[model samples]
Target: MMKNYHNSSLSLPRRYAITAVQAAAFFYFLHCSFLPFPAMQFPFPAMQCDLELSQNVIEAYIQIEEDKIEPMQTESPQYMSTWTWAYMQSFQEPSWHRALYKHLLEKLGKCSVLFFPIISKEEFHFTLLTFHKNERKWRHYNPLRSLGHRKEERCIDMARNFVNIVEGWLEYIRPQAQVFIETKKKPTLVKQKEGLPTLVQKDLTPTEELTLNWIMQNPLQFPFEDDMECAQQSVSSLDYGMFVMFYMDKIAQ
Candidate 1:
């Protein structure tokens, strides 16, 4: 499938990136008449933010879908199949094969909170389109803004691979779930450190422990002659400190 797509067309994703030259543009993309969907009344239960989508975005998508249904009644079924595949490809970021590799990661001062436990940002535009999907859970509307571009078959395969990677990470974190569950069942014993007041809990999250351990194991000890700035910091002690507030009972232990 990939080989055939690579050989025949610009692939769905790549073609979608640049203006013009896409398969949809040739086969009456915005050319077909549009059936207007009522403007955002509600995402599911409640209406989203006050901002409605641009008129062009709404009309462009609606017209794109009408032609596929229009052809189903006619004699040209083969063309319809091609059309269906082409439309799906248009949703992907790019119709071309490679990615633009740019180093976006920059260390802004550390932040730890509920939503963002650790905020390591890279240089990329942050899209702000939020919508709740279901009754119980609300998730970010479109996360694809962060993804690299790809051609059609490559895009599909990459999407599947990404989900598999996430599944593996969840599997890896399964054991850590026991920490929270078991902590509630039985109070954990602590081995207090000797001498000074500094202390940290043993049951830090996997990420926290890994970060502290990596810093300790590989000290950022560059020679005075070295000019690298990535490793340097204003407050080295606090920057490397691990916060374990697990034992702190504010009311009175």
Candidate 2:
């Protein structure tokens, strides 16, 4: 008969040591798989470590380049969103629309006129109209003109008609008004007044200075001279009244 042998031949201490070694080896394999050293070799490729290293280097380089770039200088608000900032910058340069509008105004001889009744200041009106020496009647162009019964229901029909007229005029004059390059004057630097308090000063003509002094002296009286020519070319009551009000406001401030 053979002698019976015990299955627990190895001691508990030895089993514990073997289990700890296996656990350590498994964790070491995992670590090497994810973060392998340049000199180390593993059963599987260490793609995770290589990818992370490359991505980190690229991100660092991009951050450095972005930090070196200077901010754009503009009159727009500092905290404006990206799209708004871009839109504002788009209009900063001269455009064809602005050029066309300026040409149209020059051709039309447009002027802003303020009218007030001779006896009363209550009938003050400001109008934008084209001035024509040959034409007997004034041509008033009110883009906001409407025939709607309610004030709020007014539409921009007049404005649309005006735009169509401008387009037709442009087409008619396209051949003669072809775009041509004009030489522009170089910008000159203005010397700052050093060691002086900031003050607003304007160089006025003799006539302007005399008129201003007279207006200041006789703020309430009418500014028109007795001569017929002077009366014909006299300043508008609305303009004179506005100037007086502005002066008073400034004094109060």
> Which one is best on TM-score?
1
Lowest summed-lDDT stretch of 10 residues in model 1? 100-109
**TM-score of predicted model 1?**
0.19
Whole-model lDDT for model 2 versus the true structure? 0.25
Q: Runs in model 1 with CA error above 4 Å?
A: 1-150, 184-253
Q: Pick the candidate with the highest lDDT.
A: 2
RMSD of 1: 24.9
lDDT of 2 by residue, 35-73 (tens): 221222223354433322322232232334335433332
Task: Find the number of clashing residue pairs for candidate 2.
Answer: 0
Enumerate residue pairs that collide in model 1: 13-94, 13-95, 14-94, 14-95, 14-96, 15-95, 104-122, 104-123
lDDT of 1 by residue, 87-185 (tens): 233344331111110000000001111110111112111111111111212111111222344322243343344334323433443455455334423
Clashing pairs in 2: none
